[model samples]
Target: MRIAPALLAAATLLAGCATTPMARTAGPANVPPGMQYLYGSGEAAALSEQAYNALVDSVRAQLAKGRPATAAILLPAANGTSAPGTCGDKPYAAVFDMDETAVLNLGYEYNDAQTGATYDTARWSRWEASGAEKVAAVPGARRAFVALRAMGVTPIINTNRNAAGAVPTARALAFAGLGDFKHQETLFLKGDADGKSAKDGRRAAIAARWCVLALGGDQLGDFTDALGTTPAARRRSVSSSAYADWWGRRWFVLPNPVYGTGLGSGWDDTFPASTRWTDPGDAASVAQPK
Candidate 1:
C-alpha cells in the first residue's frame, strides 16, 4: 500500500503478465475430432503421399504375379470382362481424380473459405479454367504417375472439373511437370452428360478396353457409384460390397478437409460439446492399453 509510484506501476504490470495465459506447458489431452483441419494438415499431406506409394507397390506386386484380372476393377461392363493387361492384350491404367488427389486445391479452397462461399458452380468453373496454372501437384503424384508409366501402366485422370477445362487441366498437370498425360483421352473431364458428376459410366467405359490396375482420389465417389451421402451410408457401402474391400489395395484415397462429404454439420447435434474433454489425466491413461 505504501509502495513508490514507479514500484507500484511495475508490480501492476507483473500481475497483468502473470494472469495472461502462458504458453501451454503441455499439449491438450486430445484435439477435438472436428478440428482435424486445424491439427491434421501435415498428416493429410503425408497420408496422400503414402497412399500413392502404396498403390505403386500394389500394382507392382500384381504385375509380377501376372494376374491383372486379380486387380480391382473400378467398374464392370455388361460383358464383365476387359482385356487384362497381364495377358498383354491391352495396357493397364491407373485412374485418379484431378482436384485434390492429383493437384492440391488448397489455394482455391483457402480463397473460397475466406469469402464464406459454398460450391459456386460458375465461380468454380472460372477458377478451374484459370486457376490450374496456380495449383501444384499433390505430393508423390507426379513421381507415382511417371513410375506407373515406366511400368507399362497408363495414367488416366477422371475429373469432375468442367469438360471445357480439360485443356487447362492437362496444361495444369503439365505445369506441375506431369507431362505423361499427353493424349486428351488420358484426361477424361466431365464433357458428357453422364460424366458430369457420376463417374461409374466413364470408368466402365475405360474398363471396357483397358485393364484398370488402381484408382486414387480423395472422395469415395471416385472409386465407385455405390456411394451414399451420409457417414453410415459410406461405411455400409464399404462393408456391403466385395469390390469395396479393395480400399487400401486397389483404391488409394487422398485426404481433403477443404471440401468433401466428410465435412458434416451434425457432429454437435449427435455428440454434445461437453464430451470434448473428460479429464486432464485421462489423456495419457486412455492412450495406454487397459
Candidate 2:
C-alpha cells in the first residue's frame, strides 16, 4: 500500500530542478521520464495490449481444457511461501488490478507531473471519488473484459483503493469503458475483507467463491506478497522454480514505469559489480573488458 520512497524522491529532485523561471512554463519536457514513458509513449500502450491479449488467450485455452483444480491466487503454504488455492465447484473468474492495469488515471497523473508532488493518499482518495471522467481504459482492457465475459468467465477487480470510495471507483471503471463492477462482488477494494492494504485476504475471499483462472496486474505484489521487499529478493522470488512457469500462463503483467514497488532499487542493486564498466576515453577511470 506504500508508494516507493525512491520514486517520490526522484520526483522531488525533478521538481527541485524545475525551480528556474523558464522551467516553470516548460511543457512535456518537465514531465518525469517514467511518466512520459507510461502515459505518453506508444511502447507502454503496446506492452499493456500485449499483456491483455495474452490474458484473454490464456484464459480461453484454460477454459477449453475444462475445469481447473485450483485458482491462480497464491495461498499461505507450510513452507512459509505460497501455493495456489484449491478450487472446488466454484464459478470461473479472472482477477485483475484496476489502476494502471485496466484503467489509466490520466488526470491524476497529469496533476502529479504538473505539480511535481509526491504520492499522497488523501489526494488519491479525492481522485477516486470524483475523477471518473478523468480516466481511460488501458489498451485492450475493454476488449479483454468483453471477451472474458463472452467466454463465461466473470472479470473481477481487486484493487487497493479504499472501500469508502467503492461507489465512485466503480463509476470510474464504467467511465473508462471497463463496464460495471459491483462492490464486494465483482469489485473488491481495501477494507472489504481484513481492512488491510495487503490484498491476499481479499484474494482468498474471492477464491473462496470463484475459481480464478488468470491474474493480471502492473506490480508483483498484485499477485502475492511473498515476493519479498528488496528488488533482488523480489526478482529471485518471482523467477524461482516454483513461480517461474506462471509468468505468461496463469499471470499477466502490464508495464507501469510511473510508480510502484518495482521502482525501488539503488544503482548497485540494479547493476552488478561484474557488469560495471568505464569508457576507454575517460581520463580518471580504467576501462573494463566486455
Candidate 3:
C-alpha cells in the first residue's frame, strides 16, 4: 500500500487490538520490518522468473507441432466455458497484468515503505506517469515476451491502471526491454469502457477478438473473480470444486504480499473451534498470556 508523502508525515499510528500470543510459537509476534518487501524483491522475483520461463517453454512446445494448447488460463476453473476459438483467424494471444506481473514496482513500494506513505491515486499516478526510468521488468519477463512474438502469439497487456496511465505504462515496459507490444489495441487500460474495475468484461472483449492462451498475474482477480471478496470467499473461489483443478497448467500466479485484498479486508470475526487443529498434548500445559 502507498499514500501521499504529506499524509504519511501527518498520519498518526493507530493502536491495534491487543491479543494474547499463542503458546509454542517459534517466531516473533510481529513481522520483522522490511521482511515483506524483501520477499517481493528477492524470493518472489526468482520464482516468477522460473514460472515465466516454464510458460514460454510450454507455449513453444505446443506451437511447434502446429497445435494450439487446449488450455485456457483465462477461463474460470469451475465453469463450462473454454478458451474462445480463434476469432476468424484473428490471432493467438497471451494476456498479462502490468504491475507486479510484467513490471516490478519494487522501487515504488520500497520508497513508500521507507517514507511511511499510503497508497493514494494521486501518488500512484505520479509514480506511473514519471517513475518509469526507475521501474524494471520482472526477471525472465523480457525473454518470455520476446518468445511469445516468435511463437506467433500476440502479446496483450491488460492493466487496472486508469487510461491516463497508458503512455507512461508503455514507456516503462519499453524502458525495461519488454516493449514489443507497440499497438494501441495491445494495451488495455482500466476503465476503457464502463468504469467498473473488474477485468472480466475487458478480458471477454479480448477473448472475443483473439484466442487467449494464457493468463498470468500476482492477484487471483488476474485469472478469475477473486478480487474485492472477503478472505474466506477468495479462498473458496480458488479451492472450491468449480475452480480447483487448473492451478499450474492453466493459471500462473505470482506472489505479491505488499497490497492485496488482505490489506483491506478487516479481520474475520467468526471462529469455530471444530475447524481448528487438536494437538495430542493437554491444552492446560500451554501458557496463555492474560
Best by TM-score: 2
Better of 1 and 3 by lDDT: 1
Tens-digit lDDT track of model 1 for 43-129: 766887799999999999888987555445544435763322232356687888887788875456545433433456777768777
lDDT of each: 0.65, 0.83, 0.64
List clashing residue pairs in candidate 1. Answer: none
Where model 1 places Cα greater than 4 Å from the true spot, the runs are 1-40, 74-88, 180-184, 191-196, 241-244, 265-290
Error of 2 at 235 (Å): 1.2
For residues 1-290, could you state the per-residue lDDT of candidate 3 as single tens digits? Answer: 12122222111111223323223333335432333543445676688887787777766765666655353545343466533334445578888888878887766765664544456787888888888888778777888898899878877887887688788888888888987454348888777644657777777777767777777777777776643267667766677655676566556776554555433333352334556554547565344332
Each candidate's number of clashing pairs is 0, 0, 6
Give the per-residue lDDT digits (tens) of candidate 2, residues 241-267: 989999999999998776788765767
Model 2 TM-score relative to the real fold: 0.91
Best-performing candidate as measured by lDDT: 2
Which residue pairs collide in model 2, if any?
none
lDDT, candidate 3, at 171? 85
